[model samples]
Target: MGIKVNLDEMLHQRRMTLTELSGRVGISLTNLSILKNGRSKGIRFSTLSSICSELDCEPGDILARDHSSLEGED
Candidate 1:
């Protein structure tokens, strides 16, 4: 995928556990794991907002684009 989820790194910087984030964000661990592992096809804005609020970060902090992969795209 061209978009990478930097959840693990953000969590590490915040010293937060997935379980704790799940509770704070009112999301399930399974769903959070899918996101953390980069297995998610997409994410809801509300969900992203909640995560950002709890983690004290922006969407850029959690997600990044692989410019190299887009180099050949029109």
Candidate 2:
């Protein structure tokens, strides 16, 4: 399974820019960009909470699990 971040989609849906979200979420643009691009390995709970608060979205809306795995069945 893999975890996916749909930050870009959410940002578009909310009509907000990455720079604006970075400022509002108290996170650096580079770090936010990394997270947005799915290059981030992990995110802190506090940071996630701040992002959710600013975007008015839940964790489920921002993240999803993909069950397609190569190690499972043949």
Candidate 3:
């Protein structure tokens, strides 16, 4: 496990669609889709800022620590 994106849940809680978020965030649907699905390798702070602003949430709300993998590291 790694950093898990919580975009799906946040979108659902806001009753907003990906399409709508894309428009508001000025990000392409394809890119947003990738991020939303947790398939993105990374995200720029500007993009993240836009998303957080539009969604009315913080980065912590959209990203969560996946501690399961840490247990085996040591």
Please give the CA lDDT of all the candidate structures. 0.93, 0.88, 0.90
Ranking by lDDT: 1, 3, 2
Clashing pairs in 3: none
lDDT score of residue 63 within candidate 1: 93
Candidate 2 overall lDDT versus native: 0.88
Question: How far in Å is the alpha carbon of 22 misplaced in model 3?
Answer: 0.4
The TM-score values for the models, in the order shown, are 0.88, 0.88, 0.88
Runs in model 3 with CA error above 4 Å?
Answer: 69-74
Give me the candidate number with maximum lDDT.
1
Writing each residue's lDDT as its tens digit, candidate 2 over 1-74 gives: 66779999999999999999999988999999999887888999999889999889998889897576554532
What TM-score does candidate 2 get on C-alpha atoms? 0.88
Question: 1 or 3: which has the higher lDDT?
Answer: 1
**Ranking of all candidate structures by their TM-score, best first:** 2, 1, 3
Position 21, candidate 1: lDDT:
100
